[model samples]
Target: MRCETIREALSARIDGEPEPVAAGSADRHLDACADCRSWYRRAESLQRTLTARPGPPVPDLTADILRRLPPDWPLSSVP
Candidate 1:
């Protein structure tokens, strides 16, 4: 398959979603195409980074907890 076509399918293949190319086709393309291989490597690294990142904090969690507790429960309110 052409690099562009394979590149688009690379993500689907990695994610185990449906892709245009048959099984082993992407691997074959990667072996023969340095550019596609590099692109695939970069994409894989990006997915790893994205999946590893911490999710966003719960919204206003501190405020909600503080509201549920007594004011005297605070250790230091000066801050």
Candidate 2:
């Protein structure tokens, strides 16, 4: 398989989504492809780093948002 295709499958696998290619096939490719193995390691490291840190706390804007909208803002006038 092409490197591009294998990478896509690797990404899907990393994301816990279904891989486009079979797992065994991707693994076999990884075993033989040094570039792909490096790419996968980097990708995994990046994923871990991204998910390990917590971002700034999110503010609740629900009330502020609702107050700015008209009562019937989302509803069309009936004929």
Candidate 3:
């Protein structure tokens, strides 16, 4: 597998996102590629850092958007 594809899979795996069976291929590539190994380490570190810290308060973007919409806006037409 290419470095770019493996890197994407690495991030997705860290995020607990779904991926194909080829994730194992990415792992094997990690074993062979020093740069990918470093990237994986950094990705892991970042994931840990994010999990350890409190998330910033997330604004309710959906509600904000609803408020901005006109009363006559065709909500039913939105996908």
Candidate 4:
């Protein structure tokens, strides 16, 4: 993949949303592109930091959680 294409997909690649074939191409691009390598490092650092932190506390957690949940029954009205 070209550097521009790889750069465009870098965030999604870091988020683990990229297809395996595209990931291989992006990885190969990172090996040769210094700018992309630095970007990849920064993205990796951010992902790690975000995952390590405790998430925000929810107020009225029971009601809020229930409101956000998907309908459990197949025929249930979601909204």
User: TM-scores of all models?
Assistant: 0.68, 0.72, 0.63, 0.57
Once all C-alphas are superposed, what RMSD does model 2 give against the true structure?
Answer: 4.6
> For model 1, how does the per-residue alpha-carbon lDDT over 1-66 read when each residue is reduced to its tens digit?
788889878989778789888758988888999999899999999998998999987676877767
Of models 1 and 3, which has the larger lDDT? 3
Q: Candidate 2 at residue 66, lDDT?
A: 70
In order, candidate lDDTs are 0.84, 0.94, 0.88, 0.77
Error of 4 at 60 (Å): 5.7
What digit string (tens of lDDT, one per residue) describes model 4 on residues 1-79?
A: 6667787688776777764456778878888889999987987898899999998986768676677676674435536
Model 4 compared with the native: what TM-score? 0.57
Clashes of 2: 0
Clashes of each: 0, 0, 0, 0
Which 10 successive residues of model 3 have the least lDDT summed?
Answer: 18-27
Candidate 4 residue pairs that clash: none
Model 4: per-residue Cα lDDT at residue 5? 79
Question: lDDT at 66 for candidate 1?
Answer: 70
- How many angstroms is residue 30 displaced in model 1 relative to the true structure, after the best TM-score fit? 0.6
Candidate 4, lDDT over the whole model: 0.77
Model 1 residue 26 distance off true place after TM-score fit, in angstroms: 1.2
lDDT of 3 by residue, 7-56 (tens): 88888899899755377798799889999999999989988998999978
What's model 2's TM-score? 0.72
